[model samples]
Target: MAAFSPELTVIYATIRTLDDQHPQATAVLVGGGRVLAVGSREEMAALAPRAHVLDHRDLILTPGLAEAHIHLVAYGFSLAELNLHGARSVSEVQARVAQRTMNTPPGTWLRGGGFLLSELGLDEYPAAAVLDEVSPHHPVLLFSRDLHLGWANSLALRLAGIRPDTPDPVGGRIVRPLGTLLESASELVTRVMPVPSEADFLAAAKAGVEDLAGRGYVSAHTMAFEEPEAPRALQTLAARGDLPLRIWACLPHERLEQARELGLACSPGSLFQWGGVKFFADGALGSRTAWLHGPGFAGGSGTGMPLDSPDLIRERGAEALRLGLTPVTHAIGDRANTEVLEVYEALRPLADEKGIRLRIEHAQHLRPEDIPRFRGLTASVQPIHLQADGPMIRELLPHRVDTSYAFRSLKAAGAVLAFGSDAPVAPPEYRANFAAALTRRDDEGQPIAPAEALTEEEILWAHTRGPALAAGWEDEGIIRPGARAAFTLWDRIGGNARALVL
Candidate 1:
């Protein structure tokens, strides 16, 4: 039975239905927040005589845009915090930190992120003394662009009780000079930061969603990498009917035991829901922490550090699947991808039985031999990284550049290619995502894998349909019966777009 809307609404736009049978429509009649009828304006008007018609015939309409991956609340806090995403030198970083310090009260913790070692022109990790000169009184913690590594001033390090004699924790590293922390090591320091009040978290989430909405995103996949309080903030907003974006959240695999204890199930809510149990297989490319094969980084170090052990991933992945949630692992290097594939292969039968797809968060680099292993899994990638990592990929892992950011290769192998910006690292701007995926070119105008560049239609589908598949959202990413009426109207297929929800 068709669900009649409490209010009949008709939207007249240049509709690209994204549906095979009827690929295009002149207008769409939406009611009850779901697409009712998509057809010619005259036909839809005749079907709904008393419908409220919204005319936007000049713009192009498609499914609501989904960001697919981000640390929502964290991204929000970043908006007001320092931004070092494009700082070209250590001195520049110091200058910015110093400037911020002058404005901030002494002894207060100073936090900021988004710097590339390569961009800073440094081949080695920096030391605390560098930050000491400017931030003598205040404790400081700054993150590398990839967010896998952190640089802390002496005060912050002392606050975390990380002394020179302190041994490195399992699955993490402390740099020789005692200023930098990598992978899990950074977490030890971050855990010391004062916990925000529920109101604080709620405000951050609101800022994050409103920012994305301003960028034309109607929904997002808030990857779980923040404090547990973060998701709670989102849930609170949803419970109060204040969330502006639809959220599909993930749980850190470490919390699976706690989640199971609470009898948490994969049930939908009004605007927020739990989806994937997230795990990090390795660190990121820029941080040089990505687990790679032999001949690691041309002139650099080890076959990047592995984070979550395969044993842990397999055990927790099984638990996540058993709970009817997706097992999402992050893999950025060839070896990382290879290891994750082995784990997924072992869990295939279980996932199949549960009717849930396994997912890999950052299948960035791959061995030609392992490309086909991605079949039947979601390749959740951030194309925006390629813009910055392009030159680095060429310089660090030249041998793999041909296959790096292998979008088309993954798709041809039957892997779902869901696109995102990995925001707080890169801004969640669709234009950047579109440009990077369509051109496969770096900032230097060098094509990383031109052959892997996708068409406008393919990119749109990845940004829309591919994400829907990742989240198991059957009634989104399309304009058809039972699909959400949320739509994004574009000036051109790859041009500026805005969300229009009925």
Candidate 2:
């Protein structure tokens, strides 16, 4: 019998295969799901006469996209819950929940997320009674748009064992007259919920990863928020050789010791790796907790919550570097970014010595002068965030309009711009990222700061090469012979297409 060789698949088209040497390979030879070679259609066909061929003549093929930052498990859960992301007022939120309750069984949890206090047009926290009126029997748990704060109904408060006397946790706050929990305080309620079994965890992780792959994502950086088992669940998938895409996970700062004891360092493996140490510097803009300098927002009374001291961040960040882990901090506001940049500057020499780069997540808003300091750092930002935040940004940070989501300027200042959708906070919508980054327009169709908008090519680079560089994976982002075989097909940017990867 003739030697049985691996079957080949030749993808043909006006190809945009992102291949170097031949950046526009009209045909690709794929074997065992990896691109075996790229050449002219005649050349590829001659080499693999028995190959099965796929003709995507109308599509553009590019490197598989990467979401530089996201919270995967949380996004999976949010997909099953009520979405109040764009509710324009508190009444809108209440009405939606009330309608949802009418269909839901009486005692079931009325779980929901994605309410923005700014979008709700509320000057202060909503009274817990407001949720009580509509959800008297059900325990209502609503996460703020940023996921930093949670608003609960009376039933949920009781369920969480929280009371007026329930003192705030060290790194969180329990609002007075009882309804809201910030930061660590949100965990009080979350901790009471039943832990999902291994099956549930696998199901969620699977759904989330599949959804991303469908959206042209070949890789993601999962920001840790859940228990240690969550990352373990992801590891199980990779270990079993069942994982379809690359996953880089972070360990919360508190778990640093645990990670150390396991002798885990960044870049531990290819499929699943412990890549970064995550820290929260301040809250979110939607919840009005984004730390800022001087007057917080134009008309808002508060300047936003001050969070983990810079000194602490610097100290812990250095330790993470020593352990060969990338230190990534979430900083939403100018003040938050300012402080984090300061911490990074203090530890720059060490980071350089250790060959680790510091990343600042959601560097959404910036002070004019501080923008340049992001130079040589990874600004892991979410362009999809602008769609939901455009209007509110106009109201809150009107004075800093030109500087908010300053993509062009950040790039100009020499920052590596990695774009992502902080799913659960905002769904992982690459089309939306393309639209928002290129247009800088809000949902209302008004330009937030037109000058800040990026070109289509620029947006693509940020979502592709910028993210790969940030993750320290040079070979994966570009389409080269030795690069990992991952590619996304596109009919057009901001349009539908399929993803193909090995």
Candidate 3:
């Protein structure tokens, strides 16, 4: 039978189809937003006689990029918040906060993230007094780069009812003297802070999607770490056909019951859709809260904080699977990985039965034995984080750096490696991801473990095919018949990439 008519033929010099049937295709015939034929320019042109032809004989074409994990709308809002991404000292943070305070009213909530304690050159948490001196009037809540920790000024702390005497919530810590909050403790302040209005969420989501598209991402698995309004904003944009990229969103496990009450499950849509339910298995490495198998962080006292317990994950994971949503867990530390793996092991049969893949977000650190447990599961990781976390990983968990960010090993063990930037933690820059994975180097120029580095092709597959599988999107991240015609044009592999959606 003849391919669909009124097609749009995309001609390129080199096209990496990511399809084994025809690994290389110079042209793709697209109709009705689906790829109708993948072959040579002549073949495609012949297949669609009167089709619109776009010629790019020099650029390389590949499947559209997928951000495996990101806080889509939050990152958008952060674009307007104080960006402390590169501040090297406490004074720098104070200076940024002070400036924002000077510009705004005293009582306004000042929120921002993307600072690291290590970046501040601190052995201990900085006191809130410094921030008080800068902006005593403003309520300030800044988050550590990993978003696992929060740094709140005294005004902000007092507003949240946190005092030196306040007991830490389970799975979270109020760093005493009231300077920082870890894990769920940050929620005390965050919950009390003003929620973003619907308009704000919509604006943020639009900005975030446009930003991702500008960076060449055609789709993202927006790991819903934000409020309900966040995804609603994306849904609104999708409904209006204003969304620039495809979105597969996760619901926080806390809201799983709400989703069930609404009878919501994995409903597929063209632009934005809900796909999985996300749970945090533990905290993050930057905050030293990633539930570890101690003797933990070298000279530290604690192993790490475990967030949602394994039993909780087991229960909700089954519910998510039954509801046709993937059970995605953020397992950072070795212990977290182990516990989540145990939970996944139990849910595997159910996931198989439901034809859904269980996913592990940020499978950052792992034990060698547990690596194989990821077999047939999606290892959703941000390799770009390695550039900054490499030195920290070496200093804190030297014993596990080899297996940390183990993309190759995960893939070798039958795990699908979905690569992302985890923006707001790190920007969604594919070049950063390419460098981090290909070199396995820290920002300090030290190689974490060169042997763990991946090849160019491996990186491409991880960023493309792996994320597609994780989101249960087969038409994306590949160029083949019946696949989405969405694609990315790269100057070269591991170089600049731009979305080329028709």
Clashes of each: 0, 0, 0
Worst 10 residues of 3 by lDDT: 3-12
Better of 1 and 3 by lDDT: 1
Q: Order the candidate numbers by TM-score, best to worst.
A: 1, 3, 2
Superposed Cα deviation of residue 225, candidate 2 (Å):
1.7
When summed lDDT is taken over every stretch of 10 residues in candidate 1, the lowest stretch is 1-10
For candidate 3, give the lDDT of residue 397. 95
Q: What is the lDDT of residue 26 in candidate 2?
A: 80
- Per-residue CA lDDT of model 2 for 311-420, tens digit only, reads 88888888889889899999998899999998999999998998777899999989889998988899999998888788878888887788989999999999999999
Winner on TM-score between 1 and 2 is: 1
- Per-residue accuracy of model 1 over 241-268 as CA lDDT, tens digit each: 8887889999998899999999886886
| Per-model TM-score versus the true fold | 0.98, 0.93, 0.98
In terms of lDDT, the poorest run of 10 residues in model 2 is 1-10
List the global CA lDDT of all models: 0.90, 0.83, 0.88
* TM-score result, candidate 3: 0.98
